[model samples]
Target: MSNVGQHLLSGGLSGFASTICLQPLDLLKTRLQQGDGSSGPRFASPTFTCVTIASTSARNLTVFRTARDIVAIQGPRGLWRGTNATLVRNVPGIALYMTALTHARSVMAVSPYFKAVQKYPSGDSRTRQGSVLPTLTMQGNLLSGATTRVAVGFILNPFSVLKARFESSIYAYESLSGGFMSIVRAGPSELFRGFLASSLRDAPYAGLFVVFYEGLKIETYWTSHTTSAGIHSFSAASAGALATIFTHPFDVIKTKVQVRSEARYHGLYKTIRTIMTQRGIAGFFDGVSLRLSRKVFSSAIGWAVYEGMLMLMASA
Candidate 1:
């Protein structure tokens, strides 16, 4: 009905689609990051110049082998180990993020600075036709993205803790509810064990992603003199990839904290210290490539589908 409503619907559908298509990769990334620097799924040759934060064995690991290992250990359904928890986390998380983005842009559009600038030729034009103003300055984009993601991350951190544990060897949850109850028994605070690290990762990643994606879209729209869904997808993928590279270490620490039953890596500082002491700088970047792949693919597909659905909904 409304643009914000449309954004919420589009975000949910897009997140659902991406989660289903890429759950296996997400599983692998979590598992890889969860492993101590002795063993985990391998992605390439042992000599491929990857930082082995997983194992000292140093054996070659491939995606196929990793999938097989999962299958062998947990059956074919094992690949989707934490799918329910993931859905529980992402659907609301994405919807809220998009809604926040829309609101943030709307707020920015009416800012004194924006009103002053909009008198020029480069001003927002969507309002001319009663459409929502979508343009935002780079600063607005980064701040809004970071704020939305961090806000949503706090709401969804409980699901995140469950999902990470389900995906890791730390816990073998029989079902989503069972896992949730277990955590509740552990204590409500346990559900937010890694909230700080999660915030650190999510805020920066989301901020950078929006900065890169929107910046690229504006640049390409001007430079190429054309716009298309394909271009949007490419920009989303590029943004996701870049963001993952920068925030991946935080991801590793977050996973470590979430899945651990003990307080070994208790706080963010302790986690970083332990990682550095045990595995060095490379430890923080364990599964960087896998994470990049998942983020790029999922974000591209999700954003493309979201934008396309928004257009369709508006036209209808």
Candidate 2:
């Protein structure tokens, strides 16, 4: 396969693996973010009420309990309720994001302003052991990560809306195509419901993730004089955790905007006001643990597999 093709394959495989492994966490996060209808317009559907009842009790909304409730209500497969939508969104979404990010970094690396200072030999640009991609300056990492992520995010946001609704109890979408058509019928506004909030979350999250991941790898090498896939995984996971925490509020708002039909959630400022007024400061952190867990493992597994595949392909 060509380099771009390899990047796509590698990213798709990584996304598939991570999504499958971490799907339950994603479902829980959606349910958690969906919250109770108490703060907004309540759906009249019994299914919505039932699902909300399972996780709405302040004391009973723990992740384990919510997960158990899902299994009780919809059987074991309930946890993977949105697997198809997630796969549709994440597989190509991750592939495009990775490819765009790689291309951006590669292009930037050739520019003197973004080029990494070479402290080692020239043939292989692997400044540190197990680092396969071209290293750029911190500014390069931030810019490339932010711009590429937002662009890919914008392209795949319709699928993102589908995925969010699929995971939430608010929508009873019969099929992926059906859900997609529903959004289409709702018009372009619904298709890009949370684009602004999503962009806000993704831009900084991607930028900081790259900056922290690269910085951690370099720092680890400097401190321990070693680097490997293990170190890369650690760095990526740590970076993901930090970035997830920082950007989680926007995530909550984005989920609300996409999944709920209430007028309160129809706009960014209104959603913020509703969350703060109803759920307080802690509201923004809803489902944070589940998101953190999923992001950490996903980042670790995804980046490790992506870089490893690229390295193998290059060596071959």
Candidate 3:
């Protein structure tokens, strides 16, 4: 396969894997973020540190309690409350990823590094080889992922507001009427919602995601030369786990900011400060276990399926 193709394969796989495996934990997190139960940020965010969820009867893992809580209040369908939003988020994220990666790979093909190697005194022998090209190409991939993620975020901010609101509160789920209008009426500055945070979070995480995925495949190629889907799965899981940690603070702020009508949190900085000073450092990582665990499963399965789908598409 072509190197560009390989990058795409990895990207698709990562996308699918992240979704399926991480979704359950993600469900719980959304419920927590929306304040579906009890008081405190635990309702708004669901910290692992919450003693209430622990002290409650009929619970083992927070996953189980999260499920019970949802079913009791909202019924079985509630389990998937924000699922469409999640899927919606992924589609654009992937579309942007594909476009960016393709462009990046193409630009770097004839870049200076490859040109230097081509004109080098030691070797014209490898003139048309892909090995030297990928080194230069990966840099392009990083740039492309970052740029496209930013561009994609603009198209997607309204949807993000939708997701946050829907997941955070039943009121949002009850009415999908506003659509983009909600965002438009949100005022010029607020339209982007958590965009800057999302952009910053997505770019580097996506870049490293590519790097780690490619590196895993290379590492496997060195030993057994297997093409297990696990490499893509694991890479995505790892990347998602890491991204969650860096981005959770912003994630919290976004939800609060998007849903607030009175501007209790003001801007991103103020929102963060409010959360920290009022709730402490642990508040920032609310629902971390659920998020991390979800990343492992969702990234693994979603990415594996998505990559397989792409290969199927390409061959067809």
lDDT of 3: 0.56
User: Which candidate wins on lDDT?
Assistant: 2
lDDT of 3 at 216: 50
Assess each prediction's global lDDT (C-alpha) against the native. 0.75, 0.85, 0.56
Residue 312, model 3, lDDT: 51
Q: Write the per-residue lDDT of candidate 3 for residues 1-316, one digit (tens) a residue.
A: 7645655565655555565445556667755543311233322222111222222211123557678877898897777676666666765566456646556655665677522222212343422111221343356545655677667777878777776665654333344555446556647665677777676667776665555554553444344333445554665577667656666665655665665443446677876776666566755666667766776576667555555555455545
Q: Which portions of model 3 miss their true places by more than 4 Å?
A: 1-23, 34-64, 113-141, 310-316
TM-score of 2: 0.92
Best of the two (1, 3) by lDDT = 1
Tell me the spans in candidate 2 whose CA falls farther than 4 Å from its real position: 36-41, 44-60, 119-128, 222-227
Consecutive 10-residue window with the lowest summed lDDT within model 1: 43-52
Residue pairs with backbone atoms closer than 3 Å in model 2 (clashes): none
lDDT of 2 by residue, 1-316 (tens): 8889999999999899889999899999998888643633456234222223232533238888888878998999999999999999999999999988998999999999999985344564454354667789989999999999999999999999999989987788788998799888878998899999999999999999999998887776555544466767888999999999999999999998888776788889999998888788888889989999999999999988887778778878
Sort all candidates by TM-score, best to worst: 2, 1, 3
- The positional error of residue 284 in candidate 2, measured at the CA in angstroms, is 0.5
Ranking by lDDT: 2, 1, 3
